[model samples]
Target: MREPLLRIEGLRTVFRIPGGEFAAVDGVDLEVPRGRTLGVVGESGCGKSVLSLSVMRLVPPPGRVAAGHVWLEGRDLLALPMEQMRQVRGSRVAMIFQEPMTSLNPVHSVGAQIVEAMRAHDPGASAAALKERAIEALRRVRIPAPERRFEEYPHQLSGGMRQRVMIAMALACSPRLLIADEPTTALDVTVQAQILDLLRELQAETGMSIILITHDLGVVAEMADEVAVMYAGRVVERAAARALFEDPQHPYTLGLLGSVPRLDEERERLLAIEGVVPPPFALPKGCRFHPRCPFAIEACRMAPPALEEIAPGHLAACIRAPVEQSVAA
Candidate 1:
């Protein structure tokens, strides 16, 4: 088997609450194979975004990576010094944040921003060369009139255009790993398709691995090679995309897939997973998801279940995994 481009082991990111700290991302173990996309899917507050930020080491103040290793190409990122980590961020691993409006500076022109990103890694390069390279980056993402778009500020462009610019900047440094958090939020369906296609084309060209974090299971179905379903700060199920969609083992994964509006299936109403994700500080004592799991029994409330494999490369945390077999018996 080919070695994974990125490997995460027991990652935990904690935030300070009033009296103590709570782990927003708890004990996540994931691997993104070289040139393959790994989709992290879950509803709001499930710590999908925090997991991505933890990998980037960009968790805001009062939130820190309390434990675990983020191994990128065999190097432990969490162990790196601040300065070394800064150097690794843009040139080695880049992120496209959820909101381009806030992520992109309102003051700087898009071209200058891309140029700055490049200059960080290639400071000795002449200004003219960097500007040319930035414009080329815009063109690479299929932005029309690359020169004019380059000079425009973030607000001047349409939402789709801004997203393209974000993608362009992310790819500018030719990083090996790209973590995109909700790259298509608030865009129309047409534009969403375009951005996803652009990412696919770029991945094909560069052979770079992607960690795509989003709540849209539809997007994951179309883009991801593997899927990890998260709930209440932990991954509940992990499997290849087809295996997951065809035979989800965890109740939460079933709930998520059932909730998506399917064109072929007829239903009076969309299925919704009952109850909100529990607050990290006030998580349930046994299984974190037992409160909402329809299959919960007395045994489920006894202790947290381990993520165990029922079949090759398919893992679930629920005790009654291989749920169909368990249900049939």
Candidate 2:
């Protein structure tokens, strides 16, 4: 197997609140191998967005990375100086945020934004070359009339178009890794499928790895080569997408799978998780999910279970859940 394009080890992001510290991301370990897509799935406030921000060193002022390493192409990004980190951010790694309407500047022309992103990483490039490249990028994302749309402001474009522009800017420099945090959240179903298909096509052409953060299991099923299920602030299960869907090892994973709405099944009501995700500041002791976990036991209440390998590549962080039985049955 190829060396991982990005590897996060024991990543912990903490925020200072009124009285104490809160962990938005706690001890997360993940890897995105070159040319593979790793989908991160969880409900809201499960630390999915925080994990992405921490990896990029873009955590907000009151919050910061407390420990662990973010290794991109073997270099420890956490140790890099601010100036160097800025260079690496867009030149090597790029991100497409959740809301393009909010993320894109209202005043700037979409093309101008893309050009600025290009110039930020490559200051020596000619203005004409940058413009040409920007237009080409717009075309690559399948935006109609790249020349006309280039001069339009964010408000002038539709939601789907604005998202395409965001994607275009992120891929403008052909970064080695792209972190997409719910890139299709605000768009309609048809547009969402188009955006996802575009991402897959772009990945195939560039061989760039992607970390797709989303709460939609259907999206994960469609695009993910591997899946990581997170709850409260930690990953509860990690496995290849097929293995995860076929045989989820953790109770949370099973609950997530069970909650995915099925079109074929005739049901009186939709299945859903029992309770809400615990607040970051008030995470439960031991297993964060213990309070809501149907399979919680005394051991789960006493101490947090470390992520353990149950099969060749699958991992789960639940002490009471029987991994062997799940895989066998």
Candidate 3:
């Protein structure tokens, strides 16, 4: 059997708030195979973005990965020195942030940023060579007249164009893994599809593995081979995308699937998962999602359940997975 491209074991990322510390991401374990994409889906603040940042060691101050091992191709990334990790980041792994505008430096032209990224990993590359590669990267992402766009600042481009530039920079290094956190957050539906198609095309060409973090289930269904549904800092359910979506196990997962407006079924209002995700500082004693889970019982409030394999290659954290429902809708 081949080894996983990226594997996370007992990953726990925490943050310090006003009163005390909060475990933004707690005990997450996942594996991404080579040339595959893992879609992490969850409501906002459920630690989806935090998980990606933790993997990259880019969690901003007041927040850090407090525990666990991040293994990439048999090496423990968590144990690597800061300088070594820096070298590993762009050359072996890269990320496309949630918002391109905020992620990009407004002061520098788009071309300059791409060139700088290339130079960081391949410092031997001359300025002329790097610039040519930068322009070629832009062309690769299907940007019109790449030479002109290279000289423009992020603010000058439309949202879609800016996103394309972000993708270009991330792929310029040809890293083995790409962690994209909400890469289509603000784009229109059509543009969203285009960006997704572009990513698929690039992945097909390079055989790169991707960790696509997004709240959009539609995106998950379209892009992911495997999906991990997160709730309150932990993955509540994980399975092949079709299995998880069509035969959801956990209540949270069911609620998420129900909330999506399916064209096959017409409904006046979408079913929503009741209650908001509680702040990590005030997380519930047992299962963090028990408060919002309609089927939660006394046992559920007493102790959190470990993620157990309910079926081959399928896991769910809820003790009462594949919840028993009575007849008659």
Candidate 4:
């Protein structure tokens, strides 16, 4: 088997809450093969974003990685010293945050920020070279008049354009792994499609692995080679994108799929998963999703089901996955 480009095992991150600590990311495991995209999908407040942040070692203050290893090309990122980790971040692994306005600096020109990122990785490179590379990055992301845009500030560009700039900066270093957290958030439908297409084109050219963190099933269907379905900080199901879409095992996974509007199947009402995601500090024992599971049994409320392989390359944290299918039929 080919070694994965990125591997995460038993990863846990915690936040110091007002009352106590909450495990924002709880014992999650994931991997990404080189040149493939892995979609991390879950509802809001389900720790999808935190998992990505943990991988990059950028979980905000009051939250820190509590356990597990983030392996990048056989090297353990968690064990690396601060200086080494810093070097590895923009150089080997880059992340595009959810919001561009918050991520991009208001004070600095887009060109200057990209140049700064490049310089961090390659300080020996001359200013002229960095500027040229910055323009090239913008052009690669399909920003028209790269030189003109390079001089523009973050506030000057449209939302989609700012997102492209974020992508430009993330790819400027040519990192092997790209973690995009809701990269197309808040964009109009047309802009969202354009951004997704741009990402696909760039991935094809660079062969860079991507871990897309989003709740949009449509986006996952369009981009992910594999999908990991997360709920309440745990990966409830994982499989190839096609397999997961065709045969979702976990109740939450099924509910999420049911929520998407189908083109062929006509329906009066879109399905919705009952109950909001439980607060991190108020998570229930046993299966976190038991309350919302339509087919929940006594066993579901007894104890947390371990994630087990139900088929080759497919795993789900449910004991009655087969039964659920039978019941649905």
Candidate 5:
């Protein structure tokens, strides 16, 4: 078997608050094979974004990676010094943030930003070659009038265009892994489809692994080969995309799927998972999701269930046994 491009084991990220240490991402493990997309899905504040930030070592001040290892192509990223990590960030693993408007520098032209990214990774390359590569990158992302848009600043471009520029910058060095955190959140449905298609095409062309962080199950259905379902700072379930969708083992995962609107089903009322995600500081004992889970039993209140493999390559933390299997079979 080919080695995975990125592997995260027992990853835990914590923030120091006035009260005490609060973990945002707790004991999460994930693996991404080369050229495959792994979708991390959960509601807001479920530590999806925090996990991405932790992977890039960009966790904000007061927040620190408390434990675990982040290995990229066999190199331990967390062990690398700041200078070395900086080199690895754009060259080996690039990230596309949720909002391009906030992510892109307002002062610099998009073209100049791409050129800078190119030069940063390959300082020995000539200016002419960098310019050509920048233009090619834009074109590869299907940014029309690449030459013209190259000179335009972030504000001058549409949301979609700015996103394209962000992707171009990320792919400037053909990084081994791309971390896209809600990359389509700010765009309209049409533009969202376009951007996702472009990303899929680019991934195919370059064979770069992608860690897509989003709450949108629709996007996950379309893009991911594997899926990780997170809840209250922990991964409750994980499996191949089709297997997860067809047989979600965790109650939280079931609730998430139930919430997604289906075209074939017409109902007067929409199904909603009741209650907001609990804050990290006030996490409940046992299963963090038990308070909201309809299937929560007495056992769910006393001890947190360890993540266990229920089937081949399918793991879930829920104590219940394959609830979706009889329904599907």
Candidate 6:
């Protein structure tokens, strides 16, 4: 296996609350090899978004990275000074937020925003040069009439076009790693497919790694080289995309896959994971997922299980992982 372009170890992000603090992202460990995409799949509030923000060191106020290291090309991002980390954020690792409308500046022209993103890393570049590069970036993402669209505000473009602009700004600096947090949310199915295709094509062209944070398993099936199944704030399972889809190990992962409708497999109706994601402050004992796990047993209530290898390169936090036996019982 090749060395990963980005590696996260024991990452924990916590937010302040009334009593104390609760971890929004708890002990997540993942990697993204060069030119590959790592899909992070989980339901809303499962800490997937928080984990991405932690990597960019952009966790909001009242929320902070309390533990672990975010290593990017051998340097520990968590240990870098604020100014140094700022330099690394866009130039080396950029993010495309979930909602482009909210993420993009409402008042600024799309072209100007991309220019600002580029200027941050290349301050010495001339305004004209930046404008030309910004337009080129928009064109690269397959946005037609890029020159005209550059001057338009976020509200002026359609949802799909706005999303493309977000992609353009993120890729403006040509970062090595692109963290896309639900990049296709709210778009129609056709537009969603286009965005995913654009991402794959761009990755092929740039050889940049992507950390795709999404709740859609269908998207994962289409794009991820590897998949991480998150539950409550931890990575409950991690495996190669093929292995994960073919043979899921953890109960939460199984529940998630079972919930997605499959054309190949006939089912009377889609399955649903029972109960809600336990609130961070009110997490359960032992396995965080025990409350919703149909196969959970007494052992699951004792203490939190550690992420352990169930097969070569496949890891799951459940002790009964390779959970087929539990399924049989």
The Cα local distance difference test for each model comes to 0.92, 0.91, 0.91, 0.93, 0.92, 0.92
Measured on C-alpha atoms, candidate 2 has an lDDT of: 0.91
- State the lDDT of candidate 3 residue by residue for 61-114, as single tens digits: 999999999999888988999999998898789999767999899999999999
Residues 107-212, candidate 1: write the lDDT tens digits.
Answer: 9999999999999899999999999999999999999999998888998998899989999999998999999998997788999999999999999999999999
Tell me, by lDDT, which candidate is best.
Answer: 4
CA lDDT for candidate 6:
0.92
Which run of 10 residues does model 1 get worst, by summed lDDT?
320-329
Give candidate 1's whole-model lDDT.
Answer: 0.92
**What TM-score would you give candidate 5 relative to the actual structure?**
0.96
List the candidate 1 regions with Cα displacement exceeding 4 Å: none
TM-score of each model, paired residue for residue: 0.98, 0.96, 0.96, 0.97, 0.96, 0.97
Residue-level lDDT tens digits of model 2 in 246-314: 878898888887777798787776667798888998888999888888777677888989999877799
Best by TM-score: 1
Candidate 4 to truth, TM: 0.97
Cα lDDT for residue 30, model 1?
A: 97
- Candidate 1 RMSD computed on C-alpha atoms after optimal superposition onto the true structure: 1.0
Q: What tens-digit string does per-residue lDDT give for candidate 4 at 64-164?
A: 99999999998999999999999899889999977899999999999999999999899899999999999999999999999999999999999999999
**Total backbone collisions, model 6:** 1
Question: Which 10 consecutive residues of model 3 have the lowest summed lDDT?
Answer: 320-329
Q: 1-329, model 5: which lDDT tens digit per residue?
A: 78899999999999999979999999999999889999999998999999999999999989999999999988899999999999998989999988999988899988899999888878999988988899999998999999898888999998998899999999888899999999999999999999999999999999999999999999999999999999989999999999999877898988888888888788777678899999999999999998998777788898998999999999999876575453345
Model 6: which ten-residue window has the lowest total lDDT? Answer: 320-329
Give per-residue lDDT, candidate 6, residue 58: 89
Residues 172-240 of candidate 6 have per-residue lDDT tens digits of: 888999999999978999999999999999999999999999999999989999999999899999999
